[model samples]
Target: MIFPCILSGGIGSRLWPLSRKDRPKQFLPLFGGESLFQKTAKRVNHSGFSAPIVIGSNDHRFLIGEQLSELGITANSILLEPMGRNTAPPALMAALIAEESDPDALVLLLPSDHLIRKEEVFLEAVRGAEQAARDGAIVTFGIKPSEPNTGYGYIKVVPGEEPVRRVDTFVEKPDLARAESFLKDGGYFWNAGIFLYSAKTMIEAFKTHQPALYEGLLAVMETRHSDLDFTRLDADLFGKLENISIDYAVMEKAENVACAPVAPEWDDLGSWSAIWTVLDKDEDGNSSLGDSRFLGSRNCLAYADQGLVSVIGLEDVMVIATSDSVLVAHKDKAQDVKHVVDQLKSEGRDEVDRHPRAYKPWGY
Candidate 1:
């Protein structure tokens, strides 16, 4: 059986004001009516997939359960992380829990934040990945880079291979010159952070690559406490475990790692600019999600909810007016919005991160 494990615990500090501690980007209604989390959850409900298990923060227990309920979807299990110990530990935790029911279970790991829209293409990729994973390969979904993007990390894979490529190396987000060289060479793919593996293979990979993390995970799993439908990892012990992503803890060092290239119209909305690229806009090349009016605007994005926002003579800019705070910045500088957040944090301004209408476990 293939069970989808949804990793839903990022703070989304980069998507501040709209996305916050309690209400992260995944749960927010950013793209249309359905939240990103709900959309991602629906993907695993396809014919080949079993019920999913969501691994999220303790603070999101009610949120996960309640939201799934509203979507008329029931998760098999909702595991609560006592603290954010990153993907490796949470993956291990889910592996332990899934092993109890089906020791030979194949786990399809998905991030709750991405927008993977092309269902047929995405599902086909997952099927291919499952076959490789069944053959003892630690599988990852890699994206065909449309541009030499320095902001995204690259997966150096075997050249000339169509779709499924044997991962050569996982490279960091490089400088512009290096990025250009990678694009020209044609051996690199963008790391989408999606992966598939069997419980047994995952356990083995963790043991081989991240022995300490595996040991700590073992300890945490040994002390795993269940409450209702959720398995809560021990707080003190889990917190003591190092905060490291799976890419560093395992994928970078693992020899059997492979990339299953998926062209699923995917985008990780990490910044405001990414949102603009994914959204639908008007004739003047502008997109307004809620309430806004624009005149003589070209290549602009304005999200207004608190009140009517009218902008004129705006070009290549983003104006987001929330209840507490509004963000107005050039599209090129959208990535630097985190700098504003940092400044706010230094000044003890909660508006930089916390949204006005906060999400709760019961209901928003």
Candidate 2:
């Protein structure tokens, strides 16, 4: 059985006003009244996959449970991290947990916030990579880039016609020139951060490449306690474990790494501009959520949380208005929203953390 291990520990600060520390983008109902987390969970709820294992922040434990219950889906385990420790630890932790049941079980490590428009294509790619994973290859799904997007990392796959190709090297986010060059050069794929590997294989990879992290997590797992339906890790031990990504800790260092190049119309929606692209637009290229109206606006996005938002004579601009905060910026500068979030953080602003109306288990 392939265990889908969904990672949901991102703040998504770039999508602020709508996405906040208390309730990040993954939990927000952005797509047809469903959050990205719910979509991800539904994607793997079919026959080929087992009950998902969610690894997320302890602060969002209630959010995770509530969302899953809303969909009538129950997770195999909801592992809570006291604090953020990046992807490496959770990757190994999932492997360790799955290994307890079946050492050779395949674990599909997925990020919960990504949007995969073509689920069939993505699942077919997963099915194709299953044999490679069972053969002891740590398969990373790489998206075939439709454009020279500098926002994402790149994976260089060796020339092959096979379903799974040997990964040449992993490249960090590049400048525009380098990104374009990668587009011109064939065999380059966007590092989608998706992986499929045997539980035992990943555990051995961690033991070999990240021994300290492996040992530390082993100790942390030994003392893990259940909090209702959630699995809580020892805060002290987990915090002490190295804060590193799986790419840095294992994928970049392992020889068994492989790439499954696919095009499932994937997007991470990392920024407001990204969100604008995915949203339904009108004749004037204006998109809005809630009671919003546009006049002479082209390629503009306006989100109104509480009241009606009206835009006039604007092109390529975005307005995100909540009850407490309002943000207006050019679509070209959408990525810089994180800087605004940083500035708010520096000022110790409450807006940096949550909206005026907070969501809780009982009531908002």
Candidate 3:
């Protein structure tokens, strides 16, 4: 069975005033009705796929369980970390646990929050990467670049066939000029952060590339135990491990790295600007949600949760409103919203960490 290891450990500070620390963007229902997490859970519930193994925050245990329950889906396990230690440890833990059950089990690691419009194409890519993964290749899915997006990291892949190819190198998010250069260069693709590899294969890669981290995580796993519906990692031991992303920990340094170039229409939904782009707009390029209206507004996005929001003669603006706070930003300056969140955090503002309506085990 192919295991889906869903990573759900982000605060999503970028899309703040709407997305908060207590309830991140993944849990919010931005689209039709289903939340992004629920949508992701439904996407992978296909033939040859097993129940997902969710790696999420300890505080979000109830939210995770409740959301999965709403869809009549159950996870294989809910691994709770004492603190956020990035992707490497939980990824290693999932592989270790899967290795115990079946060393050859394919682990498909994906983010909990992402928009994938084309399910069939994505499933095909997953199936396509299975063979390469079984052959000891740590395969990551790459998106065909449509623009010189400076927000996402780029992957350099060697020219090859339809499904998979040798990954040349991974590049950080570049500046405007470098991003444009990459867009001109036909070999670059956006890193989707989706990985597929066999349990034994990934474990070996970790051993070879990040030996110390691998060993330390193994030691922490030995002390792991159950907490009701969650598998709790030993707090003291886990805190001592290095906080690093899986990309820097293993994939970049590993020799058996591969890239599955896919055109599945995926987006990380990372910022307000990204959200505006995906949202349906009117003739004047205006998009509004809740009790919101626009008059003579062009290229403006407005959201109102509690009250009526109206925009008049506004251009290239983002207006988001909740019961407690409202945000008005220029479309080009939407990326700077996180700076506001950072300042709020430094000032010890409650708005930085939570919304007016708090989600709980019982109700919001």
Alpha-carbon lDDT of model 2: 0.93
Q: Tally clashes: model 2.
A: 0
lDDT of 2 by residue, 1-364 (tens): 9999999998999999889988999998879888999999999999989899999998899999999998899999999999999999989989988888776799999999999999999999999999999999999999999989889999999998898999999999999999999999978999999999999899999999999999999999998899899999888888899999999999999999999999999999889888888889999989988899999889999999989999999999999999999999999899899999999999999997876787754545
Model 1, backbone clash pairs (residues 3+ apart or across chains), number: 2
How far off is residue 214 in model 3, in Å? 1.1
Per-residue lDDT tens digits of candidate 3, residues 195-302?
998999888888888889989999998887888888987889899999998999998888889999998888889888888888888999888878889998899989
Instruction: State in Å the error of residue 240, model 1.
Output: 0.8
Clash pairs (backbone) in predicted model 1: 62-361, 63-361
- Give a tens-digit lDDT track for model 1, residues 100-167: 88978888888899998797798888887777888888889988787888879998888765556698
TM-score of each: 0.94, 0.97, 0.97
User: Which regions of candidate 3 are displaced past 4 Å?
Assistant: 360-364
Whole-model lDDT values for every prediction: 0.83, 0.93, 0.88
Provide the lowest-lDDT 10-residue window in model 2. Answer: 355-364
Instruction: List the pairs of residues colliding in candidate 3.
Output: none
Candidate 3 global lDDT: 0.88
Model 3 worst lDDT run, 10 consecutive residues: 355-364
Residue pairs of candidate 2 with colliding backbone atoms: none
